[model samples]
Target: MVGGMHQRKAEMARHSDCFIALPGGYGTLEELLEVITWAQLGIHEKPVGLLNVDGYYNYLLTFIDKAVDDGFIRPSQRHIFVSAPNAKELVQKLEEYVPVQDGGVAKLNWTVEIEQPPPPPTPASKQVGFPALKKAEIAL
Candidate 1:
């Protein structure tokens, strides 16, 4: 098993050329958002997709559209992912996707910047420790 979820996610993303989120619960949503976020940050150029599967993701897709309308998400950024009602369509969409040179430049009236937040303060009572383990102990 993977040592942790975060590490597993990173490994998966690194190995993947594209991402397709199937209909699932909270974990699925979280993973989908994380990959999209990484794409937004210019960390990866992979195409992300959603297999709608009987319109399961319809509400979520609508929410994303609402976010764009509310100025929270730029219209161009919406193209970061594509959705289709079935696996074949989604796969075809993904295969046809081409990464834009400008990283999907949004015609927004504002600028986007990466902000670094200050590190969290460590508690005085807790002691940080590292454990030695074999690489095979973790798998994604």
Candidate 2:
């Protein structure tokens, strides 16, 4: 019974094994960035991935690198998320993702002891219903 928007997001993040942001506008980017920030702060160890279908996120990726180069984003925090062009590969990258151990910039109201990641995604991992997602932007 999550009542607020941010509350719902937190609830989902708590329950989710991984996060996969679909192709969309500001809301998608906001959530994606929030999760990455969480990982950077050692708040959680969940895998964050971006499904970069059809290069939709190419400029955004480049911008992120630029931020790294310009010192806006620390190099240590740059690799917090993984990306791929399709769902299968994205999921695989997610499966193999290792959380970054960054000393976060922002403080939070609550503390969560990051859990150990799940075992690797098996060959039978659920990689379905994503064929239509071939041209979407993502953050997982």
Q: List where candidate 2 sits over 4 angstroms from the true fold.
A: 104-140
Residue-pair clashes per prediction, in order, are 0, 3
Task: Determine which window of 10 residues in candidate 2 has minimal summed lDDT.
Answer: 107-116
lDDT of 1 by residue, 1-140 (tens): 66567767877877888999999999999999998887777777799999999999999999999999999987888888999998888999999987544545443221233446657778753655433344445632
Give Cα-based local distance difference scores for all models. 0.81, 0.82
Q: Output the worst ten-in-a-row residue range by lDDT, candidate 1.
A: 106-115
Candidate 1 error regions (>4 Å): 100-140
Model 2 accuracy (lDDT, Cα): 0.82
Clashes of 1: 0
